[model samples]
Target: MSALPTTATHEPEAPIISAVKSNASAENRVHGLKLAILLGSLTLVTFLSLLDTSIIGTAIPHITSEFHSLPDVGWYVGAYTLGAATLQPLSGKLYAYFPTKAVFMGFVFFFELGSLICGVAQSSTMLIIGRAVAGMGVSGIFNGAITVLSAAVGNEKSPLYFGIVLGTSQMGIVCGPLIGGALTEHASWRWCFYLNLPAGGLAVLILAFIHFPELAQKKTFSMALVRKVVPELDLIGFLLFVPPSVMFLLALQFGSGNTHAWNSATVVGLLVGSGVLAVIFILWERRMGDRAMLPGSLVKQRMVWVSCTYGMCNGCCMMIASNWMPTFFQAVKGEGPTLSGVHILPSILSQLSAVIVSGALISKLGYYLPWALGGGIIMAIGNGLVSTFTATTSVGQWIGYQIVVGAGRGAGLQAPLVAVQNAVKPSQVPIATAFLVFLQNFGVSIGIVLSNVAFTQTLTQAIPLYAPSVSSQAALDAGAGAGAVRDLVRGHEDELSGVLRAYSEGLRNIFYFLVGMSCIAVVLSLGMGWVDVRKKKDSTKSTGDNEAQEKKVEEKSLNEA
Candidate 1:
């Protein structure tokens, strides 16, 4: 709860440094072919970074079977998420202190290394480790891409570049399951990891040739500078934030099943430990002030906190739906993995389409709140309808329901970021943006864990009640996968009917949970203040002068950082 930092530093060199950067930036502005190449590389990296998050979902059953470790299903996704969340904040600091181009390529190399590990992993443990490493690499890609793009183009063109990258990454999310399914079915599941190699290599190669503008001060590295840069990176905040996050997510992942019950000592201990660590984290952040992961200075703003909360909810909806939809279709509808992925396209396409439309509308109207509220309502309705799905649910019903939720999600997903960015000073935008992205990704990790618990718990209880002859342990052993369930009940008509019904009900329970999440988003969206994106009407002279001033201020801030 410390007051936010003011732009009132007393450093003697600040003004001189700012003036030098202002002049140099104009000279280094990128254009033409070089600009296009930078954007294309950024778009590719963004796509691959996000692609890993959802691609594993369709292949989870295959991974589970190969390792004979059904209980470790959630870890496949959560492990990668843990790494991403842990390193997310630090990446922002790293960019501030190091050469952006070198740092970005280094992270990409790390990502590729991870994918290689996963592709060659012989055990479930190895795969999880690979995922964690890959997640660490992905953690930096999005932030780095944004920073590079912002520097590559002027303010007027930045939004369009960001939109193109965002849309492409989203399409990657939609295509992940399809790609995972195709690989797992026709090729080896390992191909999913190998797939990243060539595409990522091409991106890195392009980045190697394209130079981006960087603060001149960061080019020099010395032992003397280490002391100065270390505090700015805020390693203490990172250490405090990561443990509690890991504990909380692990507690949820282990909250059910034969080995770990809700009230078991392991679960109870982790829950209590997570709470204690969270309290410590808050205290630590309060002390760190501007250096905190969720910096107290920027977070004190109302828009910042509201946007963070909104991000958490949005992340939950996005990750849960993306990860679970393929599983649901295969299990309840008896579709193959490839076909199952295809079945969910209506929703993904609509969400992407809505995002495009939403951006245009918000740009014109200048207010994002209406879209946010409207999206929440529509999402809630969609989830409610989806909660009624059963084995007999028609194709039209599922597709229509998905379209509704997809549209809702797309409409409001970026609004919170817009609100926060507009509310902050130019200097605070980087940290503010990083903090929001961290919360959103953290929400994704939490959502996947919660969904796993709910789905497993429901299926565990319902399978026994619906089919008294089938053991709950038997169904549990089959895994939370359509193929697994089919294998278990194959040639047993009555058992198949009961197990399918149980699976359907379990999926419904998850949708119902999302309904509540969507409703909460609506309430949070209402709390967002009315901020217009449109430029205020002013005399031409004043408008030009203000633009010039703002540009200098932003560039100076970037240089100082």
Candidate 2:
């Protein structure tokens, strides 16, 4: 087996000449234009995958009402997330075995098919299944984009491209809720899913015309060398890992409210089962070495571990804010869902600005550590300020605080990826990037569960305190049933105002917990080593030269002996 091409051997400016020398420059220009088109198309595909998550969140209430179940509603989100998480590790395997273009294009088809199914879903179960399928497709799309982008630009330019790709994806997330809300209000909630069809179709058309040399040819895996060069897909790992993750998520979504208690046997059983399965899976992976779904040695690296942790923490904070802010506006601030979605505009804009500015600055300055630290601090402060939110708080105040939080999140989001990519050997970049994303998604799931638990507990306690005269039965009825509490308050506006105040206070209390989480993330950000993205090309050149020199000395000494 021959070694892969290195940065030292690959020249960016090597020109290609066809039979006619007169047309060489024209050919090069055409090639550059095609490359730009390819990047744009791939970026759009990546954006679509991320857009689905946030876009659907704003429409959760509509879906729940149509399906007639709140308990099962979380699955609308969870199903997609579970499928994405389960398939993430396999992306690397698919990339290694198939043409990158084929793998990406195949996943896009799956994603489109799933979206079509979701748009016309007649029941909650069908929607959940559609979401899961979509997730399975999405799991590979963004990872494939990152892999292709890295290959296109080489390692020296990867950080800038990584930042650009990530920034674009985050923009999709920011736009999703607003777009979903507009479509759901003026058109139909179904259009939220239907909208992806045209966007995805256009992306497919664009990509077809844009050629990717890296994915132009497919490679076959040899059975004899498979165990040594690439580990077989760990079916057993999937079986063990997927169930526990699902069970754990189920327990979180269902073990609260009237369904089950925190200490109930069903909840306990699921929790314990998940823990045991996770332990067994880890042990199994340790024994398998290179064959593990998550290679232990790679994870043990300091940079990898810290990057995963930071990613998880950042994910948790972002998920909590994204999920709860709309609820807060609707429940306590007396804003309609559509209005609430609009209110988040400032946060979204700020996040977008931060992402673009951060990318450009990292590309120019080359240092990412200071930005990471500053971002963490901003996030903590923004969250802490939000803890003071009250029913009387003005929209301007709310949006301002949210923008601050958004800036913090945006600034910190890309730094870890840049740091981790810089730390590892080029061969490990795909796996490392996938692992970081996986951890972040895992964190989002965990955050939703924990925040849901906190909100439920706080509301339950506060409702009774503010509405002592209301019968326990009425309070319970209002708490468990949708629109019940809102109706109750509307009927007795004077008395329920106090109850609304209490609910707002309870929600604010949860923000305190979020602030604490951000602070912990701040401490962790300090541990991520510094790297200068601006000087990355020069640095890599020097390092490669030193390595080549060392190899030459060893060769000369061997010949003399």
Best by TM-score: 1
- Candidate closest to the true structure, highest lDDT: 1
Clash list (residue pairs), candidate 1? none
* Candidate 2: 10-residue stretch with minimal lDDT: 11-20
> What TM-score against the true fold does each predicted structure earn?
0.90, 0.82
How does model 2 score by TM-score? Answer: 0.82
Error of 2 at 187 (Å): 2.2
- lDDT by residue for model 1 (1-561), tens: 345322243231232234333323655678989988888888988898888887887887667656765556667777787788778888987776667898899889989999999999999889988988998898899888877877777566777888789878877888898998898888988999999999999989988988877644453667765665676665877888878888887787777556688889999999999999999988877776665667777888888888788877877887788777877787777777788778878878888888889988998888989988998898899889888888888888999999998998888887998888887876777778888878877777777777777888888899888877777777767665566777776666677888888888888888888999999999999888887777532354587899999999999999999
lDDT of 2 by residue, 15-82 (tens): 21111122112222223676678778888888988889888766665565456544454466667767
- Reference-based lDDT, residue 187, model 2: 83
Show model 2 residue runs off by greater than 4 Å.
1-37, 65-74, 123-125, 149-168, 205-212, 215-217, 220-231, 363-365, 468-485, 530-537, 545-561
